[model samples]
Target: MKAQGVVLATRYVLVTLIALLVILPFALMFMATFREHTDIIRRGPLALPQHFSVDNFRKVLFQHHFDRYYLNSILITVPVVGGSLVFALMSAFALSVMDFPLKRFFLLGVVSFGVMIPEVFIMIPLFQLMHGLGLVNNLLSVILPSLAMSACFSTLVIRSFFMGLPRELLDSAMVDGATFWEILWKIYTPLAIPAIVTSGALTAVWTWNTYITPLVLIHDPLKMPLPLGLALFQGQYVANVPLIMTGATLTALPPIVVYLLLQPRVVLGITQGALK
Candidate 1:
């Protein structure tokens, strides 16, 4: 009994330590946002601030023009998430239900391979294609590519869910004179809530944090997203750590808020949808 008690205590302590390690950075960043610039320079990062102030956030919002960037981030993330979900649903449905020659070859050669292909590998070609179409520096460049790339995981997930659904359900819908569109809209859409939330939230968070493609494709500061805006907080000689933390905190809020809002449904759906 004593040995078992010791083991349980050790496990609890280890978990607590790991939790603290994960949380400490965000906690310090929150403190740094309110810390004076001089305090940040003189004192170590973990030190308490002399006076807590909202000045950092003020500077970020008013001085840096992060409002526009925030809006831009929203615009990019929303379309990407929504479009990805739509495409993923259709692709998954077709892959699961539709039968045609070379379907397995196409799935293996194209969709399966696409799931493993890193976006960075094709950045150059993607840029050239966007440039050819005159989409460079335009939001469409990001949105279109986002739609094209989306979450391969979502396709796999939705496909799994679709396959698990009873064929009789689709057949019944058909018997009732439901077209493919009706069956898809009425049945699949309603039951695929979990997959949608799981996929949409994942895509949204990714799109919100998208930096590399935006960095490469966008030279126009005004057209950039929150990630790009956060970059502006640093300068050559002096970096505004407080302002940077404030900007980062603000940037982190949207996806967190979104996740929180849909968390219950997301959790429930993933659990239920995994079965059928």
Candidate 2:
């Protein structure tokens, strides 16, 4: 009993230490956002601020037009997440439930291999394609590619979840005159909410933080998303640490909120998928 108690104590201490390591950066950043630039320079990043103020946040949101950039982020993130999940769900359903010639080949050879290819390698070709399609410097350039790339892993995750589901349910539904679409929507979808939410949240976070794609494809200042916009905001406020940190904090909020809200579902979906 004493030995077991010591082991449990050690585990708790280790987990607490790791949790602090993960949280310290964000805690410091949040504190820094409230400090003035002069105070930050004088006191150092780790030092407590002499005074806290909301002026930095105001400057970032109003003076820098971070709100517009935020709107742009919503526009890009929403469509990419929705479109990718829709494509992924349908593709995963087909792969999980249906039998067709070359299905295994497509799943392994194409989808699996596609995930291994880095997005950086395809940027140039993608740029040319976007230009050819007259989508260069447009939001579609960013949104379309994000949707396509995100679908690769999203499909795999959802497919794993679908495969874990009882085959008898689908087979029984079909015998009762249910079409593929009806079975997918009426039966599979209702039960797969956790997996869908998990996939959507992950894709939303990725799309929200996407920087390079938008930086390369979009030129209009008004249309840049939060990630790219924050970079520009940082450049313009290089000496102003508080303002820069404020922008950083704001940029980090959406994904943090998303994960916090759906953390349970994400954990459940991943564990269930992995077990199957």
Among the numbered candidates, top TM-score falls to: 2
- Give the TM-score comparing model 2 with the true structure, all chains together: 0.90
| Candidate 1 residue 47 C-alpha distance from true site, Å | 2.8
Cα deviation in Å at residue 268, candidate 1?
Answer: 10
lDDT of each: 0.79, 0.86
**What is the alpha-carbon RMSD of candidate 2 to the true structure?**
2.4
Report clash pairs, candidate 1: none
lDDT by residue (1-276, candidate 1, tens digit) is 999999999999999999999989888888888987778778877798788678878888887878879888888888887877888888888888777788787667776666666668878998899899998998888887776666455677788779889999988888999888778878997898877777777667778888878877887888989888777655521466787788889988777788789888666545654453
lDDT of 2: 0.86
Q: Against the hidden reference, what TM-scores do the models get?
A: 0.89, 0.90
lDDT of 1 at 187: 93
lDDT of 2 by residue, 85-162 (tens): 888888999999999999989899988776567668788888889999999878899999888877876888888889
